[model samples]
Target: MSKALDANNRRWSTLVWGSIPVVLLAGALTVDHIPGTDVRLTVPYAAEGPGPTFDTLGEVDGEPVVDIQGADTEDTGGHLNMTTVSVRTNMTLGQALGRWIATDDTIVPVEQILPPDLGEDEVREFNQQAFVASEASATVAAMHYLDRPTTVVVHDVVEGAASAGILHPADRITAIAGKEVSTPSEVQDAVRAKTPGESIEITVERDNEPHHETVELGENPHEAGQAMLGILMTSEPAGGVTVNYNLNDIGGPSAGMMFSLAVIDKLTPGALTGGTFVAGTGTIDDDGEVGPIGGITHKIRGAEEAGAELFLAPAGNCDAVKRVHTDHMTVAKVDNLPEAVAAMEDFAAGRDVPTC
Candidate 1:
């Protein structure tokens, strides 16, 4: 009985000692090195310059469409394959700490760099609401011919906005509080340092006339920050040239040209919406120049699948857009908004409009 018990004890001890290496091997194989299993990869839109790599922020099962309608006043120069995206998700505390250390060493500090090209005060004073307003009112005339000569800027100051109580966009900020505000940082700093719920006077220039507004201060959402006034202000122009256009297609912002053309057509004597679903994607500047936007092929695929009778392709992206287009999909290349609208209107008159 003693000999049998001794043999059983030896077998149990061996089994306990043998499992450590097997567990370690499994962990190593299934750990950080596994592709798709452990780590995921993504392509980001960024300038082709040296910068920190970014991660995905969010994803839409199907892409959202936008209207690229507006005056093409400023020239974006040319389109590039870069993109900017917000990042989401954080790793473990230990991994995050390591990443933070690396970023501190590698990234350029915002404080050390110069302010935006449009200037500091101009940046801080930009209004989101006004931009939407300007987008709605901006329209084109046929004889306008997309005035692409020079860029002009105008800012909109909605009459009922928070800023409307004190100022407008085209009203260049000459000073803030008691200090002369020149840059965006100074304007932001002045506003930020003020006590919550206090009112401060702002000086602005409108049509060469100077005016002052005593704005009631509000709470700043940031930690320990002063009171805030909810307002959007920008140095961007509210109206300008009508350079490029696509006719009669107000599908998405990508179809800005089409929307603009439709606006022009409706505003004018003739009709532009060819009465069919017109789909497209691109940036329409104030000069009416067509600029390339990301995810064109994906957008085209979406439009085609949606059974769009006509697709307006950004002139520069014709080659890429054409590659995926079929006989069922008629890709009409347009330079700007007016042109797109025209194409859509024409296409509709030819084909029976698809029922809702």
Candidate 2:
């Protein structure tokens, strides 16, 4: 019995000692470093951490975060903050290892944040464009929720299609077939109301003036027999209500929800945040629907650190939020603009806000 016990102990010791080298080798490979060498590899990983938070309801550098021009905006008090995630890419092996062990940041593949083929400049430009588009959608969604006027603007015109020369981008479609149209669906429904080769008159606002054009409809590129105008249109705020997002540093569609909330609060009577700190992120469409965004965990940490009372997350991201721990703030799931507003009001009223 004593010999058997000694043999078992020896085998266990050998196994434990053997795993140490294999574990070190795996760790070295994970950090892209060679064992017992000075050589370091360029790791295709990025470290993401909590970034700075900006209040959408306040001004940044003497400029309002949500600048609404040509309107008598109401007084807004409180904070509707937007959060961001800072990413460090193209890390050296030693730096990667340091970040992996020293910080609470997430280390992920660089391709998750940026493309390998495109440079940082190109990625920044693309993200800025997406941010601009999200701002437009946020403005339109706020206006729609407030029952304000919206016009359908031509986004693009396809070549070799009917109305290609007549309709141009940036032209706002005011009416179609002698009927008023304000949304993209309205325009499409009116066009499809007619058959192919049918001529219809369209009224467009171009360069601050109305222009009339009569063009025959063409068959839908995707549908077999449906009629199409061959132009893509999007609904936007009309009547000189211009919304300018002030942040030039932050890029991406994640700020859409906060932008929409700020617009609503500014155009309405009372404060939406009730003078308390509230931070959230999601991509909002023109219909007030909220979509999920990346980097929710880091954003949560930032918001909690900023002393936010409530954090609004997309409904789809509730599962992700559940994995993290928030000590000070409450997390509420929002599927649209109304839900976000309700969450804020409930928190302000000392009601029980929904948790992740």
lDDT of each: 0.46, 0.90
Distance from true position, residue 207, model 2, in Å?
Answer: 2.6
> What does candidate 1's lDDT look like per residue over 104-141, in tens digits?
22222233222436453453344332233223323322
Candidate 1 CA-lDDT value: 0.46
Model 2 poorest ten-residue lDDT run: 26-35
> TM-score per candidate, in order?
0.37, 0.86
RMSD of each: 16.4, 6.2
Task: Judge candidate 2 against the unseen true structure and give its global Cα lDDT, from 0 to 1.
Answer: 0.90
**Pick by TM-score: which candidate is best?**
2
Roughly what TM-score does model 2 have, to 2 decimal places? 0.86
Model 2, stretches more than 4 Å misplaced? 1-40
Question: Model 1, stretches more than 4 Å misplaced?
Answer: 1-168, 172-255, 345-356
Backbone clashes, each candidate: 57, 0
